[model samples]
Target chain A: GESVGLHLPTLSVQEGDNSIINCAYSNSASDYFIWYKQESGKGPQFIIDIRSNMDKRQGQRVTVLLNKTVKHLSLQIAATQPGDSAVYFCAENAGSYIPTFGRGTSLIVHP
Target chain B: EAGVAQSPRYKIIEKRQSVAFWCNPISGHATLYWYQQILGQGPKLLIQFQNNGVVDDSQLPKDRFSAERLKGVDSTLKIQPAKLEDSAVYLCASSLVASGNGGEQFFGPGTRLTVL
Candidate 1:
């Protein structure tokens, strides 16, 4: 079955340090990938996205990298802050308009 | 511009009871979606609507769940005789259309349902 999954259930980082969250998808035909951040008591908010044709994309203090050969994806946060603590989710869109989401990775940033 | 709007930020009901959730999408959006998110999991799509018609409901539990989008703007999801496993957050999202980069969706705060 088609599925998207994360390599870790939780990630912890000190304030001002960098953080990385990883994801993997089973479908190779997936054309688009998105990363979302969900704060406590809030809905998931869009972070960044990368298309299959592109290996990397950056936004603000975050970057998304895609490795099509390994079917892996990663999100990097620079200078992590306490406000960055949230559950992060990765989604894959296989031209279906509806993206499949993976179990989220809880990111805890300590000050 | 306003984002998606959902009513009754939280709901608690007994098992076998019925509950309904309401959603109002962003203005001018043509695509709407409903998703269920468990405590420790990502949001899962339950159904999708393109304008006023249904696009996908394969993951929806038809035996207990029903949804409708009237006039292609607002939507309502109803679950009758709910089960304990049905306790989850119901999220509503909408986009301009179902394809292309413009299809990026904006989500609402969601309604948290708890079945006792």
Candidate 2:
């Protein structure tokens, strides 16, 4: 079946450094993608999203890049902070609008 | 606006017991979804409703899990005779329109279930 997956299970970064999380999806038909940040004991929160038609989209302090050719997605965080530490997940939506999520990558920021 | 709301932040029960979780989506939202998040994994869609109607539930374990939305508003999900594997977090979300149209979804705090 079609699924989304992360390249790493966990990533550690300095507080002031930048962070990049990567994801790969199998469904070529998927048209929209979203990135979510999940804190401990909380539901996943929407961070940013990009459609298949666009290669990249920028948010307040985050950016999402989609590569249709490689079926890859990435989220970049500028100036990682302690509060930014959490599990980040990537989801892909096909025609049904029901999103399929990746296993998730834990972002650990060290001060 | 107030975000999605869910009750019973945590629950613990033995195998074979029954449990139910409630969810209230954002007002005026037409689409609602239920997802299960296991430890160290992402949330998985269990079912979706489009204004009191079922849009998809292919991943829901019908034999053990059931859900319903009344009057196209509040919704509830029930699990009967729960198993140890059922221990996870249940998340409810809502969107202004059908997700297929690319509507952004807001999520609730989620209910954590621990089946012994």
Candidate 3:
């Protein structure tokens, strides 16, 4: 069965520190990956995305790294802030642009 | 622009009961998606629609769950004889199209359903 999973269910970080959340995917043919952030009572919002053609992509204060060989994806947040506390979900495009999301990783940033 | 709109921010029902949720996607968005999100888990795709047509419903539990997007603008998801396991957040999202970039979805504040 095709599935996506996270290495950790929760990640806590201190203010101004860097945080890393990891995801493992089972589909090698998966071509696109995305990171979404969901705040309490809000829907998930797009953070960053990386295509299989690229190994890394960066956004305002976040970066997404894709390792096709290992079927792993990681999201790194620099200078974590209290406002960054939320659940982060990693989605993989299995086929036909249908994205399958993994169990989310709760990121708690302490200020 | 206004984000996706969902009605009845929260609903509480008992097992064997019925409930319906409504959604209005962003203007001009051709793709609409419904998802179920359990606590501590990611959103699971229940169905996907493209302009009033069903694009995908592979994960939908047809015996109890049904959805429609008749006008290509608004959609309704109905669940009959809901079960306790059906307690979860119902999220509605919209995208311009699935052709490029997986259509970067824009989501609405989800409707939380509690089945006791």
Candidate 4:
């Protein structure tokens, strides 16, 4: 399942499928971007991050792609699992060290 | 390293009541942040502190919301005469420093506030 809009509230996908969650950032001067996953009853946790100078960063089972031209950031999960179900949010630091978070996208993986 | 820690994992209060939340950032971390997360929404920055100094608090509602990080270690957030709209999860996060790199912030479990 894929959600590319700025306000992607939900994404439903089957287990073992790939998932793509997108975020549209508004800061043109942001040099740092991060992706976070928040589970129920817990705070948001860091997923992956990329500097403006970089285009993509990969982590275990996760990949983050950043496009400066369009100010778009996307997180790709290789194999969606039940444990991966959560609300995903993107944060951008516009040189202030204070990140502005985007609206969250809740991903629901079905077994 | 230990993650940020917050007190009162859950809170229940009525309108016009007062409440306070506490936070302890990871050891050695100099930057602390407080965020408010409403249901189905992303967390919003409420205030930021750098070693006991207020860095950014533009988003904080100074009228009723106040926070302080004393001695550059633990912090506290208080709400006077809480309103129903104030119901949300209050999260505390910490990072190494306030820099251009924007180091990943480690978050606490967050205090869920419900105002009646």
Candidate 5:
């Protein structure tokens, strides 16, 4: 079965520094991708999404970069804040009605 | 507008017992989904519904789990003879079918189940 995976399980960054999380997907047919942020004991919240047609999409202080050539995706957070720390997940939809998710990356911001 | 809603913030049940979780999607949304998230993992789609009909349920454990969206409004998921491994957070989400070719999902607070 095809799978989506993250390069790291945990990340630590300074409160004011930029944060980058990486993900790799196995299915080439995946045309849509989404990034979700989940706080402790809460459901996932939509962050940003990118279609296969575009390479990048920016929203607020977050940017999603998609490299279809390598089946890689990344989420970049500018000026990281305490509230930005959470578990991030990357999901891929490959013509299927449902989306598959990655293991998840735990982001920790140091004050 | 209200987001997706789920009941029983937390549940503790013993093995072989039955449990049911409820969900209410955003008003007027045509697409609904149920996902299971284990600790340290992302959400996994269990079932999908379009209106009152089931769109996909390939990942659902049909032997022990069943779901229905009555009147295409609210939905419920029931797990009969639950096992210890069934413990996880159940999340319900909805998306507007008219938003885009690939709609974005809005999630609920989730129901955390702990099987003892």
Candidate 6:
């Protein structure tokens, strides 16, 4: 079965520190990946995305890295803030317009 | 621009009952999607629609869940004879189109369904 998964279920970091979240996909054909931040009582919000053709992409204060060989993806947030505390999800797309999401990683930023 | 809109922010029903959720996507978005988010898990795609036409419903539990988008605008999702396991948050999202790189989706506040 095709699936997207995360390397960590939860991560706690001190405020102002950098945070990294990792994900792995079983399907090598997956070409697009996206990171989403979800707050409690709300819907998931798009953070950033990376196409398979590219190895890295940066947004606001975040960076997404794609390693096609290992079928791995990572998201790095610089200067993590308490506001960054949320459940992070990674989704994979394989030419299909609909992407599949992995189990989210809960990030708790301490003040 | 207004984000996606969902009605009945919270719903409570007994098992074997029926409930319906409504969603109004951003004004001009041509694509709409419905997802189910279980506790401690990520949102799972239930259905995808492209301008009133269903693009995908592979993950939807057809036996009890049904959805439709009419006039290529507002949409509704209905669950008949809801089960206890059906307790979850139902999220609605919309995108500009299926083409190009800017097909980013915007989500609504979602309707939390609690099955008793």
List ranges where model 3 is wrong by over 4 Å: none
Per-residue alpha-carbon lDDT of candidate 4 for residues A1-111, written as tens digits (9 for 90 to 100):
222235578999999999999898766888888889999999999998899999999999999999989879899999999999999998888877778787788999999
Q: After superposition, how far is residue B16 of candidate 5 from its true place, in Å?
A: 0.3
- For candidate 5, give the lDDT of residue A87: 96
Against the true structure, what is model 3's DockQ? 0.69
Q: Is the docking of candidate 4 incorrect, acceptable, medium or high quality?
A: medium
**Per-prediction TM-score to the true structure, in the order listed:** 0.97, 0.98, 0.98, 0.94, 0.97, 0.98
**Per-residue alpha-carbon lDDT of candidate 5 for residues A1-111, written as tens digits (9 for 90 to 100):** 789999999999999999999999999999989999999988889899999999999999999999999999999999999999999999988776568899999999999
Q: DockQ for all models, in order?
A: 0.65, 0.84, 0.69, 0.68, 0.62, 0.65
Q: For every candidate, what is the interface RMSD in angstroms? A: 1.6, 0.9, 1.8, 1.5, 2.5, 2.0
Q: Is candidate 4 or candidate 6 better by lDDT?
A: 6
Q: How do the residues B1-116 of candidate 1 rate in per-residue lDDT, one tens digit apiece?
A: 99999988999999999999999999999999999999999999999999999988999999999999989999999999899999999999998977335478888999999999
Number of the candidate with higher DockQ, 1 or 3: 3
Worst 10 residues of 2 chain B by lDDT: B97-106
Candidate 1 docking quality: incorrect, acceptable, medium or high: medium
Model 4: residues with Cα > 4 Å off, grouped in runs: A1-7
Off by over 4 Å in 6: B99-102
Fraction of native contacts in model 1?
0.53
Candidate 5 local lDDT, B94-115, one digit each (tens): 9987223578788999999999
For model 6, residues A52-88, the per-residue Cα lDDT tens digits are 9999999999999999999999999999999999999
Residue ranges of candidate 5 with Cα displaced over 4 Å = B98-100
C-alpha lDDT (0 to 100) for residue A45 of candidate 1: 88
Query: What residue runs in model 1 are displaced by over 4 Å at the alpha carbon?
Result: B99-102
Which candidate leads in DockQ?
2
Residue by residue across B11-65, what tens digits does model 3's lDDT show? 9999999999999999999999999999888999999999999988999999999
